[model samples]
Target: MNEKNFEYLRDQVKYTGFGEGLESELKEKMQQQEPSFSLSHNAHYGTDTATVTLNFKKSDQSDMYFFNSYKVDLQKDNSKESLEQTFYINKGSNITMKEAYNLMEGRAVNKDLTSKEGQVYNSWVQMDFKEADSNGNFKLNQYHQNYGYDLEAALSKHPIKELDTAKFKDDLMDSLKKGNVQSVTFMKDGQEVKHYIEANPQFKTIKAYDGNLKRIDNRQTKDEKQSEGQNTSMKQENKRQNQSAEEDGPAAPQEAKKRKKKQFNSM
Candidate 1:
């Protein structure tokens, strides 16, 4: 990416008031703790100056984002030049403003942020249809701003070890490939225990070795087959049940009439 495009993307990032508050709260908590922790950013947007607060667990652990929050501006500008609309983000949800806008961008141009629940939380993308002509650059396009509870992107660009499952697999494979297996610490029940292993050159042929990597199996074919068979069985069962119910429907009334006749005859 060139400097100009980099700057454009940097400038395009939007922030919101709720996101600011959450960020502040996180900072305060982190600073006060004796063993310091830090809040990371998962995703974010610009326009409303929105931000997302990513509270990670203790160090060197799994990588996951908690919730996010951003403010809402419920006012509109009446000026002929100024434009306004409602936008929002949520406190918790794996959503990004850019992703959301791309999904529903032109579909609902004139829509407002009245509906909160479908998928994008309480926020919708809004664009201010005004031009900014200041200092020398004449902005002809609409002043775009994303509104809602904002999300923050991670400050650390590099992928963390615990976060990437593939890294763990690769590390294991590389160790075996280099013939470095003798004894090593393996994670078990949140505790690391030392394990001894015999060096096998043809490790791929070993069942025990392959069994450990079975979690990576691509189940698309087997799962699809199982799903189709289950659906067929269910349809057949439902058809048989419906047919039996239909056949019994008329016989039930006839049996009732016969029982009534027998009762009358006995009387």
Candidate 2:
């Protein structure tokens, strides 16, 4: 077995959110020198359970192995039917296990994706549950940075106390970007109320929930409304600038909007 190749695969599995428990199994499989193999893991989040299958394949030209993709079979505790999605691994940005669970649960995740030209760009990706491809994979909707969904600005609309502190605010943003429904304290009428919030990139807002996870109206204050108006104007100007840039340069690729119709199964 190639020690260097083994270490790379081990780190990939660990960083991908499977943890270090699979290191032994991964090492054993690598030693077998198979053309390809897969590892299965069961993860639990709240009442929902997920079975993640990680796919690996040996390089044709070298002794290296690649961690290609993963399929998530998510089963909610209350529901009999489960949803499954195959998330492809890319050299740029790959979603973690928890992020996959959140996406399966219908939440958006922020990622820094690499373009074909090797340029890094930020986008918020969410699965479209209403649509599916030929392989039963849900289509992904990407809200690029040009779409004007400012997460920080959205969070500022609410009286969230967590945003007051630099460290707490950064942590909350990181959690929300990972598609987690983060718990935060909302100051309403000078009283601190506990709430849960998630990033709603498509709608360019933050969704708030009560302690019981019930959706509540996140009414904007007068100052917030004024701020939103200004933001709207700025977004419009930015949109115009982006349109001009696109017109001046080559057309932007539509690969993000396209869905492959090929049939695939979990190995």
Candidate 3:
């Protein structure tokens, strides 16, 4: 990539808030004891920012982020924006966020974090759209701020690994767009009751609850569960009716007698 392009992306990155608060205290205490390493990188592009926080676990492991946590703000302004990408670090889920930063430049974010210790953790990403309205058109997959950085064109000549975020933001965005078997929400009156209603994608969710506060299932899409409702009970009911004739009489006997009479006449 050209120097201008590189500088544009570099400006979005800041090592600020590094070794702050608990990290500072822990590192200070560790220095008195043994030694440790920790990592924190908060990348900002446009109005959105991805905050990285790696808590300390072992000594001399300070350079690496342990028990990682990542938070990606959909909008920079906090009080108004509610949609965010968040994930907690767990066993075998720890990975790097280098790819995630690239994604902010219109690249892809990896799904796991890698450490010098070779430990892994699941990057369980959740896209919180609780504050989004039915008319909201915020797309998570697309890069919100390119900042004159033509990352797509640059990758044609350079290796993508150079910009790998090694994060899970892309996976979460893909899953949301594909409408995976993820949790949706419902509401009661305006209280927002998060119970029941797989709320199939058959319809667009306007409000979680109606004016009366009842959970509204506008039911715009039909899924497998809806198909399951179409049982063979109708056919079974026909057979039962034949054995115990209803007011309309035995349907099978009438057809059977007609068949026998037709055979005798032919003979």
Give me candidate 3's TM-score against the actual structure.
0.24
TM-score of each: 0.16, 0.81, 0.24
Sort order, TM-score high to low? 2, 3, 1
* Candidate closer to the true structure by lDDT (higher is better), 1 or 2: 2
lDDT of 1: 0.32
Comparing 2 with 3 on lDDT, the higher-scoring candidate is 2
**Considering TM-score, which of the candidate structures 1 and 3 is the better prediction for this target?**
3
Regarding TM-score, does 1 or 2 come out ahead? 2
User: Worst ten-residue run, lDDT, model 3?
Assistant: 198-207
- What is the C-alpha lDDT profile of model 1 across 152-178, one tens digit per residue? 111011111222365754564443322
Off by over 4 Å in 3: 1-29, 32-40, 58-79, 82-86, 90-95, 98-267
The best candidate in terms of TM-score: 2
Rank order by lDDT, top first? 2, 3, 1
RMSD of each: 24.6, 18.7, 19.3
Model 1, TM vs. native: 0.16
